[model samples]
Target chain A: MRNLFNYIAKYHFFFLFVFLQVISIMLVIQNHHYHRSLFINSSNFLAGNLYDMRNNVVQYFALKSINEQLAQENQALMEKFPESFMKTDQQIFEFRDTLHQKQFRYINAKIINNSVRNRNNYLTINKGSMHGVQPDMGVITTEGVIGIVQNVSRNFSTVMSFLHSETQISAKIKKNNHLGTITWQGYDYQKATMLYIPPHLELARGDTIITSGFSHIFPEGIPIGTIDEFEVKRGDYFFTIEVDLFIDFNQIEYVNIVKNVFRDELTELEQSQ
Target chain B: MEFTALKYFGRFIVIIFIQIMILNHIYFGGYITPYIYPLFILMMPFSIKGWVLLVVAFFSGLTMDMFSNTPGMHSSATVLIAFLRPAVINFISTKKEFETSTEPSFSVMGKTGVFFYVLILIFVHHFSMFLLETFRLDEIGAVFMRSLFSTIASVVVIMLAFLFSGRTKKVRI
Candidate 1:
C-alpha cells in the first residue's frame, strides 16, 4: 500500500496534466455537436456578467461613431419608407387576392466583444435569452448580414461571424437568379468565395449578391455583398467568384437580431416529413 | 517557505493576467500577437520535478485559453513544450555544468545557449498550435507560415523578458 502511494505521488503532476488535457479535449469534441453543447458552452451566467463589465468600457469609446451610423441609417430608412409603401401598394393592387404579406421585425443589440484577428472570429453580444436571443437566429447590421447566433445564455450570446471559415451563407446574384454558396477561404477578411457557380453564369464585376433566404433563419432578400471578381477555369464546371462584404465588421457595434415568429412550427413540420 | 511559495504564486497570477487581458488584445492587424506566458515556464527552477513542470505549463496555458476562447489548443501546445524542455536543457547543459536549481535563462545558459533553447521551445509550441488549429494537411503551407510568424513574435517577447530579469545565484536542490 505504501509503495502504491509512493508510485502515485511520484507521477501525480503528470497524471494531473493528462487528466486536465483529457477533460479539455472532451469539452472540445462535445462542442462539435449541437445537442451536447449544454455545459461546454461559453454562454454561462458568469461569463455573461464578466463580458457585461468589459463591454461597458468598450461601449464608451464606440458610442460616438455608433450614434452617427444609427442617425444615417435612420435617415435612409425614412427616405426609403415612402417608396417601399408605394411598391407594396402596387403589388397589392396587382395581386390583391393571392399575395401574402410577410412582416419583418428587428431587435437592437450591442456587440460587447468581437475578434476579427482570428481566421474564425466569433462576436459576443450583450443580448441573450432574457432579451429573446436564441441560437441560429440571424444577426445583421444596417449594412448587411453579420452572422448567426451560435450560443446564448440569459444575458449574453455569441455570434459566429461571417469571417469564420465554417460559415456558409446562401447568396444569389442580384441581376440574375444564379445562386451559390458563399464561404471564407481563410485568406483576406475582405474577400470571400462563392462555390458551385455554374461556369456559364454571366456575372459582372460589382454585381450585387443578396441572401437567398433558403434557410428559415434569415428572411429572403437580405443584402449580402457585391461580387468583387470572377473567373472560370478551362474545362471546370464552375465559376470561382470573389465577394466584398457590405459591412465593415471591425467597426460594427450595434446590430439587429432577427427572429422568425413561425420558425418553431415550420421546423417541426419539416422534421416530421 | 510559505513566503517564497506565496511570492511565486503572486507572480504567476500577475503574469497570467497581463498575458491574457492585455497582450492578447495587441494583435497587429491579425499578423502578430506575441505570446510571452512561456516565460513563466522558462523561469521555473531547474531542479523542479519533471511532472511539476508539465502541470505548471498546463495551468499556465489553460489560463490563456480561457480568455482566448480556444478550448485546448494552448494547453496542449504548452504541455508539449514543457515535456520537451527538460530534454532540451539536458542536451544544452550538462548536469555538472548546471550544478544548481537555477531556472533556464540567458544568464545561466549564456547568450548563445539560451537563444537556441528558447528557439526550440517556441518553435515546438507554435508548430503544434498551428497544426491543431488547421486540423488538416491540405493547408499545411499556410499553417507553417502562420507558425513561423507566431514563433518569431513569441521569441522576441521571450528575449525581452530575459533581458529585464537580472541573473540570480544557482539554487542547488
Candidate 2:
C-alpha cells in the first residue's frame, strides 16, 4: 500500500492528464450522435445569452440585407393572396376542400450564432422550447431548406446546419422526380452532394432538388439546391453529383422553425410497419 | 501572487473573448481558422506545476468548446499541447538555466525561437483537433491539408500578437 501511494504520487501529473483527456474524449464521443442532448453546447443558458447579446449589437449592421430578403419574401407571399387573383369562374360551386389540410406551421426565429467552416456546424437560434421549438423539427429560410433542430433548451435551440457531414436529407430532382439523398461534403458552404442517384437517369445542370417529404421533419417540395455537376464513374452504379445550394449560409440572420402537425402520427405509423 | 493570478484570469477572459467573438467568425474557405487561444497556454509562466497546466488547459479548452459547440475536440488538443509544452520548452532552451517565473515570449526567445515554438505547438494542436473532428482515415488528405493551412494561419496571427504585446510591454517598462 505504501509503495502504491509512492508510485501514484510520483506519476500524478501523467495520471491527471490521462484522467482529463479521458473525460474530454468521452464527452466528444457522447456528443457525436445526432440525437444526443449535449450539456455544453451554445444552446445552454450562459452561452445562449452571450450569443444573444452579441447578436443584438451585430444585427444592426445587417438590417439592410435582412430588409431586402424580407421584402422579397413578402412579394412572393403577396402574390399568393386571394386579392391578387381575379375570379373568372361564373358558376359558383360550394365544396369543402378536404384534399389540402394544414400539415406544417412556421415559427419565426432569429439566428444568434452560426458557423459554416466547421465539419459539423451548428446554429444557435433565439427561439427554443418556450417558443414551441423541439428537436428533430426542420428549420428553413424563405428560399430553401436550412437544417434540423438538434437540441433545445428553455429559451434557445441549436440547429444542425446543412453544411454538416452528418446531414442527410431526402431530396429529389424536381424535373423527373428521381429521388436521392442530399449530404454536405464538409468543404464548400454553398454546395452539397446528391448521393444514391442512379447513373441511368438523365441529369442536367441547373436541375432543381427539393425535399421529398419522405421524412417527418420537413414538408415536401421545399427547395434544397440545384444540380451543378454530375458524372458517372466506370462500374459505379450511382452518379457522383454536386449541388449548388440556394441559401448563402453566412448571410442568414433569420429562419423559420417548421412544426409538422402530424409528425407524431406519421412517425408512429411508420414505426409500426 | 494574488496580483499575478488576477492578471492571468484577466488574460484568460480576454483571450477567450477574442477567440470566440472575432477569430471564430473569420473563416477562410472552410479551411483556415486562426486559433489564437493556444497562445494563452504557451505564455504560462514556466514555474506553473504540470498538473495545474493540464487542468488550466482542460478548462480553457472546455470553455472554448462550449462556445463553439465542439464538445471534446478543443480540450483534447489543448491538453496534448499542454502535456508536450515542458518538453518542447526544454528542447528549445539554449541555456542550461533560465528564470523559472518568466513566461515564454518574443523578447525572451528571440525571433527564430519564438517562431519555431509557436509553429510546433500550434501545428500539433491543429492536427490533433482536425484528426479528432473528422475521425476518418479515408479523409486523411483533407484533414492534413486543413491542419497545414490552419497551422500557418494560426502561427502568423500568434506571432503578430507576440510582436504587438512585446512592443506594449517595452513601452510599459
Q: TM per model? A: 0.85, 0.95
lDDT of each candidate versus the true structure: 0.76, 0.89
**lDDT string, candidate 1, A1-273, tens digits:** 999999889878667667766765665555444334453334566555666677787678878897998799888888866556655434534434323644455678888777776766777788888888888899987567888898887788888888876788898888887878989887577778887888777778899888888777787778778888888878778988888888777788888999877788788999999
The alpha-carbon lDDT assigned to residue B155 of candidate 1 equals 87
lDDT of 2 by residue, A44-105 (tens): 99999999999999899999998998899899989987778777777444475535887889
**In model 2, what lDDT does residue B128 have?**
89
Candidate 1 per-residue lDDT, tens place, B105-142, comes to 66678888888899899888888776765556888898
| Position A156, candidate 2: lDDT | 97
Say which docking band candidate 1 falls in: acceptable
lDDT of 1: 0.76
For model 1, the stretches where C-alpha displacement exceeds 4 angstroms are A1-26, A34-42, A45-47, A80-104, B95-101, B167-173
Task: State which candidate has the highest lDDT.
Answer: 2
Judged by DockQ, which candidate is best?
A: 2
